[model samples]
Target: MSNSHYDTSFKGLCYVNRVRMVKPSKSDPYRAVTLSVKSGKRVSTEGKGDKPEFTIPLDCKVVGAQAQAIFDQILEEHWDDKKPPVISAAFEVGDIYPDYYVGTRDKNAGKTVPILKGRLLKLHDVYVKGERIDTPVETADASDADTPAAAQPETASAETREDRTVDAVAEEAASFPSVVRLSKDDPDFEERKARLKAEGYRWDRENKAWRRPAA
Candidate 1:
């Protein structure tokens, strides 16, 4: 399949579980961490009552310096805790793919099932047990701080600054739109469609636009 067709991004609220650091091995020499994330929604049944909440399990590998630092702290703080930490975050995952395997035991001994997998790319607005964990921010080095303003990099031009200010205003104005309109002739249609889907936008055929209910 073409790479463009693959859903390369996903974002949602999930329960981060089973935090473990993987030691370097012959097969994979890099040090890494794994997180068992469960994300989904509850559905209602007509007259039968509410059906069980369906969840997609993603065994995602946590990589990159920022994400590793966050998980490293989590490991250090809760390594001895019996229960996994209750974590909620607006997170993003990338390089998603499906892995299929045969059932080894119980109900369907020989049945094949698929598991969704991805790499944990980012975690935002994270909270652990109702308390927020502030994401670390990068700061200038002490040496750079001591440098005079003249030694610092040149600032943006007035035109460029104005454009950026306008962009910031526009972005802030539309925090989350109720609908996203797209056309088949649009150059970035597929890319935008994939992104909108990841952001919980569903196609509204009647309205001829992608719609996401107000949260």
Candidate 2:
């Protein structure tokens, strides 16, 4: 709302651009405006290589200019990549910058390790795995077969019928499934193999989850 917000020449003021911003400590939320960045780059330290974002440490005074510099450096590094500008760091709070004050180090000295800034500027929507938070699609609906509506009373009771179905299946496997103990090379082996093949079962090396090989 002030003129300095527009006047970007003030060195070291860092800000996420006109991106949907969320505060980590939601007890006090900041109003989103076009963020201004400054000179240096942010650092990352995550292992899974999570898309980096900015985070204010629990006990630190992050100067606006310092944050801006790091944010600008990150953006400049990826300016021509043709993808959404992203910070190339693993996932962790420390991934944004060093535990110590990295800003104090003189650039004239032996080049210090550059920090990886995260892309906290553009948060358009939130997702869990691949599903959107609002208007969530049911996982059962994601399957090829239609999820049959389980029978329930018009006037419901406290009992959970869904749990009952699972319990019933488990009980059947525990009790009656042992009746026919046949190895993989039984007379019905061909039929079983054909059924498994039809189901598109394949061995997954990374995760033991059986899946059809990608086409």
**Highest TM-score, which number?**
1
Please give the distance, in angstroms, between residue 181's alpha carbon in candidate 1 and its true position after superposition. Answer: 55
Distance from true location, Cα of 171 in model 2, Å: 16
**C-alpha root-mean-square deviation, candidate 1:** 20.6
Candidate whose lDDT is highest: 1
Candidate 2, residues 44-154, lDDT tens digits: the string is 567743332554322222223223223322332233334444322111111133333335457735444443332121221323233333321222211112335669766
Tell me the lDDT of candidate 2.
0.32
Q: What value of lDDT does candidate 1 attain over all alpha carbons?
A: 0.59
- lDDT of all the models against the reference? 0.59, 0.32
Model 1 worst lDDT window (10 residues) = 138-147
lDDT of each residue in 54-154, candidate 1, tens digit only: 55667677643355445544553443456666776666777778897799999858999778777676677777876888774533321133434546565
Query: Candidate 1, which segments miss by more than 4 Å at Cα?
Result: 1-7, 23-25, 29-52, 103-111, 138-215
Question: TM-scores of all models?
Answer: 0.48, 0.17
